[model samples]
Target: MSQRQRLWQRLTEAGIAPGCHQALLDTGRLQPNTLKLSHWVQAETALWLDGQLLPSVPPRRYWAYHKPVGIDCNVRPDDPQSIAALLQQLPPGVFAVGRLDKDSCGLLLLSNDGPFAQRLLHPTQQHQKTYRVDVDKTVTETMLQQLRLGMRYQAGASWIEARPCLATLSAPNQLELTLTEGKNRQIRYMCKQLGLKVTLLQRTHIGQLYLPALSAGQLLELQPQQVILAAQQP
Candidate 1:
């Protein structure tokens, strides 16, 4: 294992926010200049800045939450409707892996492992995410084919191309779609382009991670291996 990482990067990996570190330095609680490059952290070294001892790196945690509609994914301490409000008991630096828009709900991952989250969310990873959608009108074979073929739409100054890995009509008005790329409200926009109104949208899967039968507002701690396996899935 490498014993060297930039001070800010090390703090971030250990679940400390960069802003907090800067604040400590600014307040004279930390003296970065006093530490030499050779003083980089090793596995057994305890971290100290100035006269204050920093806590050891917290154990990395992973969680699966059945995010409910109306809960914003963004972390806003002052907003009761935000995901942060629901995760008050979580460790200080754990954050939602990606996002579930306020109008959509279902499986969401929260973790303190930044690299793991990146592997799952980055577009180049091509991780699969499945959604069960309910539209205002009946979904036909033609519409399914169209969705599979992909669509392009202009959003403000940019054009977005959205295509599903799989698109099938689960019911007269329900569709099960799997996508490898996530764009902001892509499903709703795609449906709208086809003259369909979306009534409900719930994400059921991310890579190999499935939403268990947890009720809305329920959260479950997940093994880190489970997350790793999910991201490794083809």
Candidate 2:
């Protein structure tokens, strides 16, 4: 068979989830759709989610946004301060790839592809996301080491351990950390556990997709390949 097809066969046989590759295909990173089976997997409806043909799916789109603090990442209609409202306008079905709590801000990716979102946000992917944080107390190497070694915290009714991540001190009160998975308000909670108060929490990168110098509340439309492929990278 084709080299690409053979590669897929080998990857699957090697125990990697085929869903990961298919998600990339559905996201449009596998361009020209050589397999022609791409996108069809998740399509609904003239929609040949490759060959089915009922109703065609909408063209995929991605965005890099610098969310200002206080703006919720949710899309609840009643929540006027949600990111959707902040955009003033947006195409149908567009949403944040992952959430950044209202109290935090930074590089947030938005997209219309569900599979892409699921794949990127899935904790198993362990895609590196970087953040810059400011705290109330002076930073220390000990704190950085502790953060890098991981933390155990409540998960539902049980306690669970977090995956280790990379951390470094940038200033007396500032830290740069890279995490593969994100729990809700994890940085803030973890810092509090270490006797520090988080003052600023800003995401600066998602995989290889770094935030351009956009001021808070600004965004730029882009192709999924520009960033979707990044989550698949080292």
Candidate 3:
């Protein structure tokens, strides 16, 4: 499909009117920033008001939220401290791809389209995510060795994917890890079994994308191709 066609499909999937997509094409003003492609698509998606279709306005789009520690990823109905509180300052319908545990913080992708979010977060794709972790004690050779061979841990049930890799060891107690799976507290559980207590865990990369220098609570819009790159990753 042509770029315009793909844009149309995304817009339709996002609940934007077909005419609105055409209108955007007619105006020819869509240009995505470097943040990633999903943001580009979300920005181009048409907005709706009441029952009338709004003209293709550069939709308020994808944001790479540098989520700080201690915030829920989901929009809550009553929690004022949730990420939802921060996002509510923007337009409605914005949602997160995957999730960050309240205590875990790092790069998070948020968008307005449900389908676009699904393509990135779906586990079957096995998109690789890199994280920087800080444990309470120094990492040992034996613990590192065990992590190389996939270790099973109980998290409601026994689970294992591939063993995680040590990306970069900043200090005796600080290290970086990369894994393809995003099971609930997967890294923390793995560390616990090996006599490590996690002090901090922040995801820094997902697929070909990185968080760059975006600060806590700050957000950047993604270019359309960036989103496509992740979607096409194995």
Best by TM-score: 1
lDDT of 3 by residue, 1-234 (tens): 312214444455444444465555445433221222234343344444344444553353677789888889866747976886876675655667788898999998887655566566766756778888999998886777677666777666676655555455778998778776778888888888778889999998877777858888888888887666545543
Per-candidate local distance difference test: 0.78, 0.71, 0.68
Residue 44, model 3, lDDT: 40
Q: In the order shown, what is each candidate's alpha-carbon RMSD? A: 3.7, 9.5, 9.0
TM-score of 1: 0.83
Worst 10-residue lDDT window, candidate 1 = 35-44
- TM for every model, in the order presented, reads 0.83, 0.74, 0.70
Give the lDDT of residue 79 in candidate 3.
Answer: 95
> In candidate 1, which residue pairs get closer than 3 Å at backbone N, Cα or C atoms, i.e. clash?
none
lDDT per residue as tens, model 1, 99-193 = 98999999998887656776788888888989999999988888888889887766667778885558988889999999988889888888887
